[model samples]
Target: MKKLSVSILYAILSVAPIAGAQGDIAAQVVPQVLSRSPEEIRPWRAPVFADQSAALGYNESAFSIPKGMEKQVQFWIDVYTKYTTEQGVIHDAENVETVYEIVDLKGLKTEREKQKKVDEVKKIIAARLSTPEEGERLRFQLGQKDRMQDAIFYSGRYLEDMEKIFRDSKVPVELTRLAFVESSFNIMARSKVGASGIWQIMPYTARPYKMISPVVDKRNHPLEATKLAAKLLRQNYSMLESWPLAVTGYNHGPTGVLKMTKSYETRELGELIQNVRSRKSFGFASRNFYASFLAALEVEKNANKYYGSVVWSKPLPAQDLKLPVSVKYKEIVSWFDGDDSKAQVYNPHLTHKARKGHPIPAQTVISVPKDKYNVALISLARKDRTVAMEDKKGR
Candidate 1:
């Protein structure tokens, strides 16, 4: 609609810059803004579109414009905006301005062009995998701030275990980097749809893998979750025959991705991304899955130059700890008072919400600091022997 153009014109002119070198800013700004990776652009773009659409009462459905209707709709809006009402119509400038605000749709072409550019860049980057070096650099760039930095460290730690799982299972090594985008490697990563963990496992899907529980969800246990993630990925890879689709399947689930494949009649991941609705069919998190992964890869690839060296932990040491007749939670805390902080790190499987009646099951596998392995083993043995003697006496 012409009014859309008028609105955009107002936006451009309002901030358009005043004369000379100042006006050059807007021209320069366009590419600079466009150049930001889609991840960087999305937070800025989503709200802008939401507000504009809200003002227009244009509810953006999963399918906004039907395949061919975009052009036809724009043409009609273009025609509608060019003419003004005459018979018994109001003449005040305010009235004209009000009508124009409500109806002018001139920038359909420019808006479409901007959207196309965004869609194009996302498609190009989504299918490609960054080299390991590129991944490291992109990791650092993603880690420039505290939030993403924590995500990077946590995710990197998870990846080490995930890589081991992949190697041991003989899965492709490229799949290891999938977590880089999944949650930037954050174990606590949760999507808008409530998908949780480094791999963004939804509760329903995680349940079958024995990851979800009122007492302890395995999804929070990184190593366990990674194993599950590998299993799911391997399964999907078998059928999808493409790493990108396999990755997409991780977000969409096997059934969801398969359905999209049937509907679109294409297995191309790049093509799937261009059709925004298809991406959303999997869930909100998956909609931008490839974009974030690519951004993280680019950042991790250049990490050292951007943010210096990152500490990659050796795989968290796994150990076994047997409780004495299922001790109370607070009692266990009291025992580790001096090193209480180590409890959660070593025992991520333990339910954090357990209270008086709820308690962690005995004999759970725990991850401990490598240095504490000797002490933990010796202590548990002594306790186990004591329990055995007490049980014999009772019998």
Candidate 2:
């Protein structure tokens, strides 16, 4: 297969100097020809590969990757399965398929040293880009490799529950695999930007779903978060009318994606991603979001092929108990012989205030071990009656 030329490579170099650069230049460049019509922007041609055996599997599923996006999805599959944290790939940010090289940084001691090596590679790529006859190369440095293997291992803990949530909500069950791309099924994961849980939902986005609160941010709870994520995804699909755009909206705001669709005059996600001029809001991450998701789905669907025999974490066994009245966290822990750790493990959504003896709001449904549900219910009932009696006496 012939490599696609980086026609706009020089546009990227015209920006800022490469000194101590940490971000991709391709992402920074705003092409001068943003006025070009959608038809003027060449459509993506599926890359021809020598081995048909390595081609992506096709299914009539709702989440199937578009033909134009196969190369991008395949690139992400390599990032997830072929690469590890110790390595990084230098490639075109716009055209994910055009790879400059993959540099191994195992021996690099510090982040500064690793970045310096990456910058050196970028300089070479720049030179190559300047001289188009040298070869096909462009700009971008992606180092964060997917922990898909770990994600697959942990997904067993919540995949069944997530499927039920989406199914009950009438959303596509396969969208549950999005956890792999969002947070790698790391239940405790929280982003610097305040997106939390396996879904990586922002506080603002989760607010409408009632997932965020002072007493509990349900976004940290895998099952609860999955329900909200399902609703949010459905909302996105309703607005965009495309699974690819809806998934992209999960990363980039739906409004932004809608704006891009209008600006580019195309609803085809492949066309929007391929032709949309670079900007601050919809950049590399947004463009590749769906591709990464499709990659995750493929890798997870064929886990045994990518990762051999795997031991998946067992789903937690628990029963949901709704609190009759506001109760303290420690009191709930007392029901299980003061096993704070066990209590926390089951109800991971409790806030700091709840932990510090502040009352958990009434009607809050908490999970407790199935075996201990009866005893916990008894204790909760007794506590509720006592509170009621105190209120009656005060009245």
The lDDT of each candidate is: 0.45, 0.67
Question: lDDT, candidate 2, residue 307?
Answer: 64
Model 1: per-residue lDDT, tens digit, 7-30?
Answer: 101112111101111112122111
TM-score of each: 0.55, 0.76
Best by TM-score: 2
Model 2, 1-395: lDDT tens per residue? 11111121112122111111234433222222111222222222111212223212212455777768999999888877787656767776667788878888788766577767877887777775756633233444443333556566557667876776766676776688888777666565655457677787788888877777788989979888888888888888888888888888988888889988888788888887767463445676777778888887787777667766644655556788898888889878875567665566567688667888877988999987777789988887888899889999999
Lowest summed-lDDT stretch of 10 residues in model 2?
1-10
As a TM-score, model 1 comes out at 0.55
Native-to-model Cα distance after best TM-score fit, residue 59 in candidate 1, in Å: 42
- Regions more than 4 Å wrong, model 1: 1-146, 155-158, 189-194, 276-284, 305-325, 331-335, 354-357
**CA deviation > 4 Å runs, candidate 2:** 1-61, 105-146, 276-281, 335-342
lDDT of candidate 1 at residue 289, scale 0 to 100: 45
